[model samples]
Target: MKAAVVSNAGPDWEIREVPTPTPGPGEVLVRVRACGLCHNDVLVGQKRFPFLGPGPIITGHEAAGEVVGLGADVRNRRIGDRVGVPWMQGSCGQCAYCATDTSLTGQTAMGCASPRTTGVTVQGGHAEYVVASASGTVLLPDGLSYEVAAPVLCAGYTAWSALTDAAPGPNERVAVVGLGGVGHMAVQYASACGLETLVVTGNPEKAGTARELGAANVVTSGTELAEIGGADVIIAVTPSASQASEALQGLRRGGHFVVSGIFPDGSLDLGPRSTFWARRQRISGSTHAGPARLAEALDLVASGRVTPMFELFSKDRIEEAVTELTRGTSRFRAVITY
Candidate 1:
């Protein structure tokens, strides 16, 4: 099997032939068709994030592929089923966090934890083949394609889960900060949920694109936060924690700010003035959608409500893709197609 191996870990990626991965008990081997390149993968690979994916790891998590084989104890998931394997590969299921919500707890944390994950610590997507647990695989709906479903596994789920509070209603106002991976998806999901979406990006170039993605309004950081700009929910998808905190002032009282981005270093300053004084303002965080919610998000994609903005790259083009994204030259999303 050919994989975009991290090599020795750094800015570049090496696409090399590696032994084919096999499914273990309760696991399945997926012939990966497409894998989403997320910013989180970059941070983890470079060892800049809180914990680098255990090492000697492949660095993709948002993947969609066909199940070519199954492990000994795997059932329900058929051999030929096409599934979207997310960053959260699988969980203990019996853990207290799994019983509540995996997003709120770290028990099911994949991609960057001990016990590892399919691509990162365990081995990930970005390869021709990968392994995943039956519990973690979300069956792609009838009309969804692997390329289209790939990014939804991670970026899409993060945005959807953050914007919707697990459930968003019509007529709601949602504010999305940053127009990168999670931010772009956030705009689309907010629109799909019937909210008036507003985007806040520091870059002027993203203003038009943000509006195109479903944001009713778009403003650069230099621009004044609109007077009636308050939203029912403010999602900080920006990597800068401070910018997210500024978004809080843009939200109306009783609004919630959900942070999808994890600042590798500095904290988003949530000053005491507005963070606590507001009647219903709350600070919440959502990691990724669980299996059921991940399924729901894929359904959102199947409905055409949200489309991932991805640029396809071939195996040999892994280095270029990484460089472009690293240099901030790529627009929207980037995907590696096998």
Candidate 2:
């Protein structure tokens, strides 16, 4: 099988012929058709994730493929089933976090003592063939194509989960920080839910795009957002902690703020502890909520309520895809087609 193999840190990935993996017990071997490039893949390539080893890692968690082989104890999935491999590969079901509520089990990967994370703990879907736990894969809707389904596994899932985590009321306003891959989807989800959607982005060029994505209003900063009557729920999907903190000013009193982006540096300043308490603001972190939420995200895409904007790249052009992602030039998301 041909794969984009990472030899060392940085945006370096070489296409090489590697042995195809076979499905182990309770796992499945997928013939990857499309995989989305995420910022975390770049971070993994740069060795930023401490859980990652020295080198030669396949870093891609947003994979949409067809099952070619199934292992023992896999009754839920079968051969030729279209599935999506998410960031949270598998979790210890016996743990309190996972055993408590199946709906929130997807978050177990973050708190679980032992987690099988795709591209981090195990092999990723950057190659033509990848192994995944049968229980971890989500069935894709028939209406979604492999290229479109790929990004929904991660970016769309995260955005939808973050919006759910905020738990905004029916008449409340929702603000999305950033207009990147995840933020773009967040805006659509908020709009689809019939909530008043507001977008806060530093890029003025994205104002029109944000509105087109269902944002009722677009503001350049937190100040601008707050000046126009703050939102009841603010979902921050920007990688910059400082920018997220700045967006907090746009949250109305007794509002919810959900941080769904990965911030590598700088602490999240709460700004005066007294102000946080006085405002009665709530903060939460959300990731891949669970398979149920992932299914909901896929349904939204299948129903045409939410559409993902992405640029496609052939398997041989993996390097070019990563370059565009690192340079922040991708339309919204980048999918590597196998």
Candidate 3:
């Protein structure tokens, strides 16, 4: 099978032939239809901080495909099942965190070093076929196709997982910082939950994009952000570490700031009272939405409530997609379709 493989930590991708493997016990072989190119791919390729790798790894996580074969012990899913493989592969349930149903909490995802995934390392869905553990495989409804469902595996899932930490009520004001892949979906999800949506982005173009995606108001960085002045919940989806930390000041008394963006190594300067004052604001982060949350994300998309705006790219043009994205030409998410 032809796969996009990273031969070494560099600034390019190499297309090479790799041996296709059969499904092992409790595993499924998915004929990949599409995969989303996330920011993490750039980090992994450049060997950025927090990307633990000295070796090459297949760098895709958001994938949707059809299961053509299954292992002998896999019983929960059947052949021909259309499944969306989330960033989470599967976690060892024996851990203390898993015993508390934290897996159900949309945390504890499988890493590249997992046992049931593909490649020598964690081979993701950047290839013709991918081997995924049957444990965390969530079935996509029949109506959704692989092309449209691909981004939901990561962007949509991450938005939902972070929003879970900020359950803004109808009366609360919700601010979504950075109208990128995950932030765009965060606006839609916040709107669906009946919160007043305000989008904050440094780019003015994204402000218009945010408004079109259900955000009632959009605020650029230059403005005073009067529309969402006292936001009860602020979800920072920008990959700017400084912005993520400073977002804690945008919340109301007793409000929460959920930081999920993975920016480069950096720091933030905020007031000492941001967390200690009467507001008693809190901050948390999430990796990606787990099984049930992914199901919810799909349902939201299917219902026409949350639509992921993405630019589609062919598998051969993977490099172009990454470049276009980093250059800010591609507006929302980018997907590599087969």
Candidate 4:
């Protein structure tokens, strides 16, 4: 099998032939069709993020493929079944967090007792073949294409889970900060949920695109969002912790603020004006979505209510795709097709 292998934590990826992986007990071997390149993968390649597995790793988590082989004890999936393997590969079903909330607890249980992560702690989907746990694989809808479903496994699912956690009611104002892949998806989801959507981006150029994605209003960073009209829920998808804190001011009293982006470094600065004395704002962090939310996100995509704008790339162009992702030059998500 041919795969894009990273020898170390640096900005380099090499295409090489590797042995095709076999499924273990309760696992399924998927013949890769498409993989979505995420910004966290770039951070892992650059040695900025923590890598739990060995070197010469295959890094790609958002992947959609067909099941080619099923291992012993795997009963839920069979060969030729289409599935998506996401960042939350599988989690320990026995952990306290998983015991309490099975919906959005995989990210917290990662690297713990019995959780495994794709493209980080395991051989990921940036190859022609990869093995995944049958229980963790997201079953693709009938009409969703592999390329379209790939990015939804990560970005779309994350956005959906964050919105679910916030639990915004109909006609409530939802503000989305940062107009990246996740932010754009949030806009579409918020609109589809019957909430009035607002986009707050530093880039004025993204105003038109944000509006097109279903944002009823677009405002700059310095705008007094709370003064004019506060939002019932504010989703901070930006990578900067400070920016996430700044988004708190946009939230109305008793509003929920969800932080879904992975920041490189630096602590969150929620000053007195942001979440102090009189401000009654609730802040929470979110990562990749769990199985239930992933299914919901896929259903939304299948219904054509939400869709991702992506640039397609082949295996040979993996490096170029990573470059475009890091440089923030891609129009939206970058997908690697087989």
Candidate 5:
């Protein structure tokens, strides 16, 4: 199998030939059709994420493909069935946090409790073939293309998760910080929910993009959003912790501030702890959605209520895609077609 592997901590991402492994019990081998290139891939390649390596690691979480083989006891999914591999590759199903009632509370502990994330702790989908647990694989609707479904597996799903956690009403004003993949989806979802969508981005050039994505208004910074009207909910979708923290001031008191983006060090500078308590606001974080929420997100996409725009790249041009992501030049999500 041809795969993209990261060799070291610097680190190096190179295309190499490797033997494809057959599926073990309760697993399925998917012939990867498309994989979304996220900044998380860069973090994994740099060894900044949870990867503990002997050497190279295949890194890509947002995968959409057709199943080619299945292992023992995998009766629900058959050969040629389309599926998507999300970020939460696997989790301890028996844990209290993973229980149905507890998983949607936007708690970080739920993710920290015995979680196995794709492209982070395990070999992921930056290859011609990937083996995923059959139980964790999501079935894609027939009408959804692999390229279109790829970003929904992570970027769009995370936006759906964070916005659902905030639970904003139709009359509320919602602000999406950063007009990238996740932020754009957040804007669309918020607008679909009939909430007034406000967008905050450091790049002034993205104002047009934000507006196109259904944002009611666009601002260059968080303070500008506050000057207009405080947001009932502020979802930060930038990798910069400082930028996310600054957006907290734009939220109305008793509002929710959800961190949907991954930071470099996992450290956020939220200024004074006392001020956070004084506001009586709810601060939460959401990872990729659970199974049910993932289904809802996919349904929203399939229904044409939420759409993703992307720049398609072939697997052979993976380096160019990674470079464009690192340079923050990709206007649309980059999906690598196999």
Candidate 6:
């Protein structure tokens, strides 16, 4: 099996022949057809994730493919099933969080004290073959292709989960603070829900694209967003916490602000304590909400209500994909096709 191996020395990726992974108990071996490249992959390659140690690693979590082998004790999934391997692989069901969570939607990785996170705590799906817990995989919709389903596993899931967490009212408006991979999908999801969607991006080049992606209006900054009466809900999908902090000014009184992007070393600066108190705004962080939300994300894509914009790369061109992603030049998302 060929995979993109990351070397921590150069923090670069190289295509190499690696041993194919086999399914363990309660797991399944998937022959990966497509995997989406995420910004976390770059951070992993740079050894920013301390748990990954200082060496080579496979860093992709948005894997979509077909199951080729099933392990003992796995009854939910079987060979030939088309599935998607998401970021939250599995969680200890006996933990305090899982034991108390009665939603029956499955515990999310963010809430789990000990989680089997793909590409972080275990092998990822950037390779031809990857192993995943049968219970953790989502069945891909009939009409969705592997390339389209790949990004939905993580990027799309995160965007939808953020929107869901905000719990917007029927007549509330939504403002997406970025026009990157996740923000682009957020706009479509908000629009699909019949909400007025506004996009806030610093890049002028993306104004036209944002409008095309269902954004009713495009603003360059939070000031511009506030000039037009502000939004009822704001979803920040940019990696910069500073940007997210600035976007908070666009949140209407008693509105919800959901942060879905990873900001490793950034902190949100609420300009003044009085402003936040007076507004009575709420702020929350969201990741992959749960398996149920992931299924919903995929359904939106399958139903053609939400379409992901991505650039495809072959297995051999993994380096090129990484370069484009790190340089912020990918069309929206980058999918590596096996």
TM-score of 4: 0.94
TM-score of 3: 0.90
What TM-score goes with each of the models? 0.90, 0.95, 0.90, 0.94, 0.92, 0.96
The local distance difference test score of each candidate is 0.76, 0.89, 0.75, 0.84, 0.83, 0.88
lDDT of candidate model 5 versus the reference: 0.83
lDDT of 2 by residue, 134-160 (tens): 988999999789999999999999999
- In candidate 1, position 33 carries an lDDT of 92
- Each prediction's total of clashing residue pairs, residues at least 3 apart in sequence or on different chains, is 6, 0, 1, 0, 0, 0
Clashes of 3: 1
Model 1, span 1-338: residue lDDT tens = 89887656465678888889778998989999999888877876686644445446587888888999999988779989998777766555465555664441123573222334555456788889988887777889998999889888888888877865624456667778888877888889888777788888888878878878988887764124547657767788888877776777776667666777687667777676544553666778777656666777889889998888989988789788888888777767788898
Where model 4 places Cα greater than 4 Å from the true spot, the runs are: 93-104, 272-277
lDDT of 3 by residue, 1-338 (tens): 87777766476876678888588889898989998888877666666623332245677878889999998899988989998776666656666655655453334544322222223235778888888888767798778878778888888888988888677766988888888889988999888887788887877766667777888877664134533475778888888876666555566778777787676777544556444356577777666655777899889988888888888888888888889877867768899875
- Candidate rank order under lDDT: 2, 6, 4, 5, 1, 3
Residue 238 lDDT (model 2): 91
lDDT per residue as tens, model 4, 1-338: 99988886456998999888889999999998999998888887787766687658788889899999999999999899999998876766677766765543446545346567888878889999989988878899997999999989888988998899888988789999888878888899989888999988888899999999999988875246776697888888887777776767677877888888787886567776443446666888777656888899999999999998889999999999988888788877999987
Better of 2 and 4 by TM-score: 2
The per-prediction CA RMSD against the true structure, in angstroms, equals 2.8, 1.8, 2.9, 2.0, 2.5, 1.8
Model 6 misplaced regions, further than 4 Å: 51-55, 102-107
Q: How accurate is candidate 2 locally (lDDT)?
A: 0.89
**Worst ten-residue run, lDDT, model 2?**
98-107
